[model samples]
Target chain A: MLNIAVIEDDKYYRKDIAGHLSRFGKVDEGKSLSDAITLFDARKYDIVFIDLNLSGKMEGLDVIKEAVKRKIPPIVITGYTSEKLVSRAYQLGCKHYYNKLDIQNSFEEQMAPFLRSLVYKQEDDIFSNSFVTRNNILIKNIKLVTEQMFLKNNKVFITGEKGVGKTTIAKFIHKFSTGSMDSFIHVDIPTLENNMIEPLLFGYKKGAFAGASDDFKGLIKQADKGTLFLDEISSLPPSLQKKIIKVVEDKQFYPLGSDQLIKSDFRFITSTNENVEGLIESERLRPDFYFMAKDVELIIPPLRERVEDVRPLVDHYINKSGTSLLVSNDSLKLLENYRWHDNVRELKKLIHSFCNCNTEMISLINLPEHVIENTIPSGQSTPLASVYTKGISNFIKKHGLKKLIETIEIESFKEFYEKNHFHYMNTLEELHISRTAGYRIKANIKKLDKERHLVH
Target chain B: MFTDKEKLLHDLNGNIVRLGSIFNILNKIENSKDQEISKNEMNQMLEDAEQTAILLNNDIKTFISINMNN
Candidate 1:
């Protein structure tokens, strides 16, 4: 049974929430922020319902932030909500923010399914398998390569850092390939013992060796008329790598202790987290094998390099987790700035760990200490700053540098005047310029403002 | 013209009543198994109710600010 928490300052509302939720699962009621915190710390709750203001104090938002950090998805039910407050709630990571006046009816109709999803989803398989991205050029290129490669039956060579979704993409290509069925077989090269590698890849005849008492069909034969995905291809023995290249070239291999050549038709999809050049130079990977494997080479970019995919991925994971908790913009900004060494796999685990926190929203405060420690702060040259820079660059491209500089000067002067409440002396003092220059800048700002008004 | 405290209070009470009745309608819609209201229509209704609640809340906040300053 799911454990749920309801935190509201209003006694009547608190009871109402508890009563409604109790029908679905165990309900823990809190009439204050302190109660909510204490209850949350005592045991794990699947979901938390929160109010922005509790007893005339907005400290409840803090409690919500904390809960979201812990991964407990929270729904905010409050009578006091404005455009600013709603946006703030989402930015802080609340799953759903509701006006208490409409919440009673909406809760049963809309929120029950959301609540059920949070508590009942047992697997992470619901997330969309297709690439989730905005404008990561590398991801777009890789996708184009996948589409290009899918047209032919050529062996695919995928390379990326561990957890960069190499296997996922391989599987996607397999499914997308024409005539794909239940015939997709995956073999982890590193897991097999050195002695078993040959026998596993190329079957063995009955009494092939002391342990080979019966005939065994290998992974290659099993993958006949389908796709064979070799994960961690870097771990394949050098001897076997040479042999497999021949089999891929001719689609024929001899079983152990047998003279008969086995002919099989299988599409090859191989992936590795190792640097191929380094492996080949070290003699761990045969050069001939590498040549045969690179029929269509696709490199999956690491998470940090593909930052555009993070927001959509976060949304995908959140939705797949079946939780109502919203991710705050601040948290997303931090996530985007983070160097995800483990890539999408690490991100999936991180989201899973925090989704258990019972809160209205996931805030920066809810983020992992390591993630928070590694992130670039807001005051720095952020991702948003780059977007603004691009916008400015576009303007400069369309217009000219001189016009851009003039506009910047006017805008800066206007900002300074506004900051000082239109006090000329204060603006001059801050700008460290003469009164005349300050007056001239102010006059320019007024003209620009008038022009802007006319354009609007 | 600025509304007097008495008029503001009256308006707030009326808004609350109106909001309560809307809630009642919403409750009936939710409880009915054969809900003829389309999802988009229901969403529109909810959005409308939320806007009214927000306007009322803003007015109350304005009144509180005014009284506090006074």
Candidate 2:
């Protein structure tokens, strides 16, 4: 049975909902905002039904926000039906919104099926794909895509930060889709050239353009019966976005300079690190295309937010490497503390780098200087260092040890001059350097600024 | 003071819907005469919706005050 919470200020409405929902789950009631929050932290809830207005305040929004942080979706059962209210509810991670008048009917149709689907999706046992994540929300969404999108042959739009496994999820969807053995073509939007994007994607007949000497096949034709994952689709030019929408709708397109139309059936899965709504608001993406692509949307949380997955991911990567090297607790703690800016991809890279250590165990001493620099030490008052030594280390790695010596000297000379309030003679004498050498150091420091801003 | 007419509409819409729901419950209890709902519970639901309406009314008044420059 589901553990459901009803957070409606109306005791009558609360009792009504709780009374009905009790048949499906263990029902809890929260008559006020503080009561709702207290009940929420008391246990893990399978679902929460929240009113948009509670106790004469917009406290329901706060409850929804808190639920989203815990990776649980809140179902809005407010009486309000305004577009703006509905939009805010969805933005705050509500999957369903029901107006109050039709509560009994909605429960019979929408709510019961939804709960059964959640149960059905979990018990399917289809998470053996390589997109390994222990996050409950990610697992739930993956199950949803497999059960809904793949079975229905619908499109899925994924949104997440870079390296957070959006593409991996797309591939996992393809593996379970109808044409599982067919091609899985990945099209990266940023790599498309402005002048050649059209011909590159839709192919070209002989003599279509000046350089089009031979017939060419494109991305769409390549994925004849399988999946086509469009990465960072918001970067696609608006004109091209419109054309792709037609191809998606009709499943038929003409190659450049060809009168005949070609048909290709392909499953569509698109992803972007950028905000889709923001892109549409700015008129960068067509609303029609957004509607077509967003049949089922899945969002992956960044690795930093789901830190519990770090140890399992590390172990998985290590076991996959065909070697058994244990991670020392100190090293593991540092790894856990370090903010993984690049998500799972960065973690994989860290593990890949560890293989070169040739040591039996990964210890504190074997960790990279930059990784150690980013990690926060326990029980320490000082924040992660603003001046990370990682930049200096990267500079040495990119340039050489020689450049490191020059950079240190330049910094030393500049520090002396600034400390002496730009008295050139006094500062140069204090550093025991000639005026000419000091001038050279000053020029070198200026050159360094022109080259790049180090020490981020 | 409300800068966004859209947001003000949303706040008003929420309260209006609450009042609508309260009225519907009151009507159901009156017409059916079989609702097991408590009379005190119905009174508090109405009171809660009224408080929301009053808050939204003040918001609209503030919006008018700012616009009229009174």
Number of the predicted model whose TM-score against the real structure is largest: 2
What is the lDDT for A333 in model 2?
A: 83
lDDT of 2 by residue, A227-305 (tens): 8888998888999999999998999999999988888888899998977778999988899988999899898888876
Interface RMSD of each: 6.7, 4.6
Residue-level error in angstroms, candidate 2, position A197: 2.6
Each prediction's fraction of true contacts recovered? 0.00, 0.03
Model 1, A111-185: lDDT tens digits are: 677665653351112123455445446545654555455444567889999988887777766654422333888
TM-score of 2: 0.49
- Model 1 / residue B3 / CA error / Å: 88
Q: Choose the strongest candidate by DockQ.
A: 2
